[model samples]
Target: MHHRRPKNLRKPLLGGGAFLLLAALNAPAAVSFAEQRYHAYKISRPAYQRQYGSWARVEVPAEYRVNAIHAALLHTGKVLLIAGSGNSQKNFDAGTFDTVLWDPVANTFKKVPTPEDFFCSGHSQLPDGRLLVAGGTARYEILDGEVRKAGGGMRVKNESPDKAVTLKKGTVFRSPSGIEYVSKTDVTVPKATREFEVSYFGNGAMKPWKTKVTAAEARVFVEAVEEGPQALTTQAAQYEVVGLHGEDADNVYGLAQKLTTEKQDFQGIRSAYEFDPKAEKYVPVDPMRDARWYPTLVTLQDGRVLAVSGLNDVGDVVPGDNEIYDPKTRKWTKGPTRYFPTYPALFLTRGGKLLYTGSNAGYGPADKGREPGLWDLEKNTFTGLGGLTDPDQLETSASLILPPAQDQKVMVLGGGGVGESEKSTARTSVVDLSKDSPVFTDGPDLPQGTRYLSSVLMPDDTVFTSGGSGDYRGRGGSDVLKAQFYDPGTNAFTEAAEPTVGRNYHSEALLLPDGRVATFGSDPLYGDRDNTKLGTFERRVEVFTPPALHRGGANRPVLGNGPAEPGADGRATFATEDAGRIAAARLMRPGAVTHTTDVEQRSVALELTRGRDGRSVTVDVPDDRTLVPPGWYMLFVTDGDGVPSVARWIRVK
Candidate 1:
């Protein structure tokens, strides 16, 4: 039965008064003070009662090691967890790259060796059931020391000994190091003695340098023949450094430096690899044309994958260059595509165009490469969409192309300002691309603001959103405990049970075979948001079972047999316990989700025909790969009572 809102209450009411108002409003249209006020001005509305769900905290094996900086649900039903550095620059430098295959069925973790620091990398599931992991952190930034500003820029000395001087008296100068320098003015200095020494800053303090410079060089270094109170005094040189401001030509940026000095590894690698789940090892593939870190790997309609954004070999944005990896050729080729921002939430539209949702996973400049639009591959044109309220908050925001691929409505949910400097948002917006001109309008708002939210579309047509921070990267005690469900049918959000632990950046959640959702990973600020050294890394996994599964008894539809791989005819046979009562069938591509968006995730309703025996059925798969891309999908059969069956994995080839 459809629930209707009373005439007087067109919109939901807020607070304790909502319950009483909803009861009274349930009556026929009538004039009242409450109704008058509701009509006069829009008020903060109360959230709908949550379509309930339950969460189970799964114990992780102790040997799992690092947090899941990246995760994906593979076709083999095992989750791929990768944490190259595990969010620690020290570990990354130590060649501490780790990859693990987590088997949900066995509740066990198995180690897999990866080539490089795939930390902060991007990946997509290939048509052959392998995952293509691209780009990774090659080096780390070291905060050497503050260089004194001089000559309108930074000054350094050409001294070979690399002296750290507090200018006793002259103008500051720079040398081959290209590090910053501070300028100081002083009268004159008598002669260099044990009284003055070169000093450097390290471990949070200025230490004296062991080596001493000649009096002639020292006089030229400080440019001071006389010394006084206003005069910059020198401390003993504690250290000799090649670079301080990170401005060295070899460093690329002021930061990107090689963490490892091994002969086999450089700072960044242009290498790519495919994970072979069968052998539990990563096999090397053809290297990418350019090295990337934090790029977005999206599987295209043609079964090839597109790699976009991320820091290049020089530790800068990859510029306008984008590449496509063909599974057939097992190679990457430069594509005729324009640059989208690093890690842009790119969705493959039904029209085969890539849709940049304007949401990104915290890389590149805030003002550049972000625009909500459809990127056409053939014509290389982008038709932009406007009317979004907070484009800035789109960073780390989550978005989804609503279920049943036929409907081109896309919805963007909670996000926040770039990086950890800003607050999270509760705002929600939706755009219907089916219209001639699509513009985002306000949808139901989140109960509270959040960022880094993982919104997974469930089999029942409701979106299950979990694992986000109320603040940026789960800091400020902003770990969101509660989960929620979004029902397109009601166009509202309902609260669900919160998970056992806090989840933030590097966290992930995806639908499981038993109709439950698995959630794990939160490596924010190395897991120590609070100053207390007792910080803990979130490695334990949690599973959430929606209310639909709790309906109990034998009412759940059970599929007996179906084609593991369906061809162009798109026919798959199945014997279901609830065959006669089967209401509908759906083929949902299992999501290979990470960050905030799942590029290849989608759901398509299948045409079902019940066999005459009332114990068998035939499903018509989508012949058009455009509608149902050639990939693995979860085939679900929903009974008359609206309960979905445990999905049968199938390949829409």
Candidate 2:
């Protein structure tokens, strides 16, 4: 069942004049507070000094929530999205589904036909510009035909069986089955069971696959693939590109499901094949470490095919064990895993650090969820992100290494882990990934609670979070299908228009071509839902337009005094009760790279923005939030408006 979102939340896309940025108001009356001592860091960008301020307020119905999200990039410079279930969060032959695609230019989510599969893990655009997708119990296309660069989608039934994959040159597609056809008749078709196949094409959308059984090939330990199941998952991912580039969307990477007896003595594995579109036959690359299901494969900028995370040992997560395949070397290297096991998600930072977040104890699919965790590629370490602290109205937390700016910060949103046990949480935590102090601090809480949410950073540093579990902790509560905003300027969050419908398990919020946002997810509340083996998916798609570009500059100086006692861990402590003025103190050090402190007490509005001109000092009464607590603190400074800016160092408690 697919449906379009309601009207109120569907604020149409703003044309040229429809957009405007609200100016910052410094109208707050100045109270006669005592002054305290302080050290100010100078900011060079004056045009942004006062302007980098921000604030956010919730704007939607209090109850609506979001579930799951599916995202893809189109050649049209747009992001196509599909969502499912807020009420039930269905997907797996469970609940209803919706479908929609967003046009960033028009700022609209044009509703499309219901998705064919409730569970599709992979999505990619074809050389002909067709969309290639893999995942679900089996694979099939929601598309109508062939893919061309400029044209829309077309449906081709000849290769329409589950798990048919297509790749275009320059497109991010991989597989052992991507091959070229010697003849149209020569095609290696997958068997009818779950033994799916992924085929990559370089010239045409696809090549002839050799489906016919070859005794000669079988005699040499080659098994003939008859009817195949769909792929485990698919996205526009290719093998890693090391030094130079080679081949193209030349190979196909996907899974083949099989019966138990196939490898009973051993843990049977679905074959992972690569079809060379140029070569037109199935070339066996390395199989997944063995029977791991739903693995995410990404082609690093260096051209290495790194498999992210997925279910192993009967649909559960086996932490660490990052599977890597080298196209040039045609081999596999299992990357380091975090802890013994983790359900961590893999994300690349601006510095190319493969970051994994969230974790689970014991068998991920079976046992309990743990506190937030992260895997750092650069350090080869696994550490906690936040604690049991709940992130409000967020779902399935996400992290992004922001592009450099006044608001440079690693943002973490929502909470929600596996199954009914782990539902929604209402906490939004932002961590300063800098080497020194100010490590993890609670950012603005989500207006509501959610988890399994989606967040992305724009060029200007503005961040967006949308859809997930309503409670947001991910421990099983209300399914949420809504959108929100994070203004790095004020370090606050704001909710968008009301969620037209509730989405639970299957939905996503994606960015569009013209910079608008698209929200697509499951909606069991709708009608005519299909109950397929894949899952009861939803596709209630919605679009959102931003208020205007709010490019923030340097962070404003805190109204606290500093140079206080530090902590063993290195965070600075500010005790307002012990001082005359000021509470929070911000200190930044660019040259020495260490800044930490607390106001002497009783201080406000230090105006560190002028530090770049020289050193700006001010006195104030310590802030209550700072001095009231008895802990170490750190002084940090930023030169941005929309977010906290400049940090010199910190003093721990």
Candidate 3:
């Protein structure tokens, strides 16, 4: 029966890999998709809204509330956090900064020099050990490597705030770095307000903590624009910081998103600049693709560059279209698929599925940002497909989860509906892929509903959820130090023995490749305050290791109730498995099958009877008009227990 099979049909896939895959494609034939590349699934309910906070994994500090998150991976398997907030009320909208590192190796945390904490930029690791950062505030935060012009040098403000002025004159020299910037103003006003705002730009030197001053403070390149309608304005221009290479702070450059006047035409600002490690200056190179704002920059396995999404606006209330940027071609192309309007949440699953979860379209109750979605890159434009047991609502929640293994189950930690809630919920849901429903089990619920809670999955298949408050929208909130963990077997959650730091919006929990989990940030929604800061954003990193598992449960193999196989006790071996989850077995007994467990192995026993005329009685289970596969069998019956008393072994060919 082993003849040449059609290319479309490859059968008899046996093993764990096949078992897992079969579950995913259980209904492959029933789905008709427009793009063979991507298949779409439907949902009965519509998706819902936006959640605001500098709530994520950040370790930066400021004198104000934090509101943004930046993630990076170090060679040591440690996760670095650059948390910032642009809504600091200290001196108007001046933001704060902090740096946090979660070391997986040592299972702890450490603090590095603060990176440029601009708003809305992605971080990438370079071939060397340095980081390549791009985008954020329109004005830049330059740090490492920059080459001065052949006979030139660049000078930023270092003295009086009166040296800089804008046209309309509402406010001027309010540096994007959130520090004091001087303007070549009437040069008369003396008290322009001096706050502890720090800007890591100019000179490229590691100034341990120098206060920023205007150019007149023993510097050069002062300006006085007596031009056009924007006349007599001496505004200093700024650029975004890409890196901070202290020792060899040379050949550095800033990248910017292409500016658009009307939001349509993409005037491709394909510029690449070189930074002189010596002079600390910027030199522009030929452009590369169109400029993108807040796009994700990832290094492919093959050393290629890809820029995805952020093709819309920085201030956009919703996520936008997808696009691809190639480094070699220096070109931009639209991505084959559109992304779910998800925010503060995107993951590349262990199964190679791209997940975009929890986002609002506009502003409404229906738009409370409760939609979780997935996309298949193997095929293009394939998403809007998800089948939760409820199949109706999608709530926004965050957590850490270990991937599934033959002996391990994935656990989801603390997640609840976002935006405007009464109390914080500490519910933990666990998914045992080894089962059919991939159903969710309940874990401990927190005292209140943690709106923007954070989690990090540890190595031992256990999940850890840290600090999240019982407050909503920054109103009447209190600290939730009690942490929780999930156990799948019993489908429950319990409080961990330890307590975590109090946290609010824009905090992060990182699991280092080594073994530690770093927790930091609380950029509170109120004005910048210490208790609100958590100091988790500081250098101190906490390490945690959940207890190890002790074997106890019996066998739990994935099988079906298809038919009874001929065994000493009627049970067929799942040895001849396939990519399809549909399994079949035949019984040697003539009676119906019954479930009985022996040493954890399920089997059936049959009893046969003789008819009055001394002949055997038979019962038929029809395969009426179809040819079944070689392994998928039917249970033959003759009188009792669906087993055949005579001619028990029949090979149907």
TM-score-wise, the better of 1 and 3 is 1
- Give the lDDT ranking, best first: 1, 2, 3
- Tell me the spans in candidate 3 whose CA falls farther than 4 Å from its real position: 1-68, 71-73, 77-79, 84-117, 123-134, 139-314, 317-319, 325-333, 342-344, 357-370, 383-396, 399-401, 405-413, 416-448, 526-542, 545-653
Per-residue lDDT over 1-653 for candidate 1, one digit per residue giving the tens place of the 0 to 100 score = 99987866655444557888877876555556668576333321212111365666777767875678777877788888888877676787688788888888888888888778888777887777788887787655332232221111112222322323343333433332333222222212223233356566776676765655433121111211222222232322221223334322221111112212111112234678888766778888898876777788888878899888777643457777889999888999987567766678888877788778888887667777787988888898988888887778888889887877778778899898875656778988888878888888889988888888888888877789886887776766678878888988789988776676788777888887777888878866535556344345678888887777766334688899867887568788887667877888888877766676577677788888988888888999867666776777888887765678888888866
Q: How far does residue 221 in candidate 2 sit from its true spot (Å)? A: 21
Candidate 2 per-residue lDDT over residues 354-443, each given as its tens digit = 434342211243332243444555477656555335522222455554433223355566555444344555666666555443355777
Best prediction by lDDT:
1
Number of the top candidate by TM-score? 1
Superposition error at 199 for model 2 (Å): 49
TM-score of each: 0.74, 0.43, 0.43
Error of 2 at 422 (Å): 7.3
Summarize candidate 3's per-residue lDDT along 257-290 as a digit string, tens digits: 2212122211111233322212222233333333
Weakest ten-residue segment in model 1 by summed lDDT: 252-261
List residue ranges in candidate 2 displaced over 4 A.
1-69, 78-305, 325-333, 338-343, 350-352, 359-388, 391-395, 403-408, 471-483, 523-537, 549-653
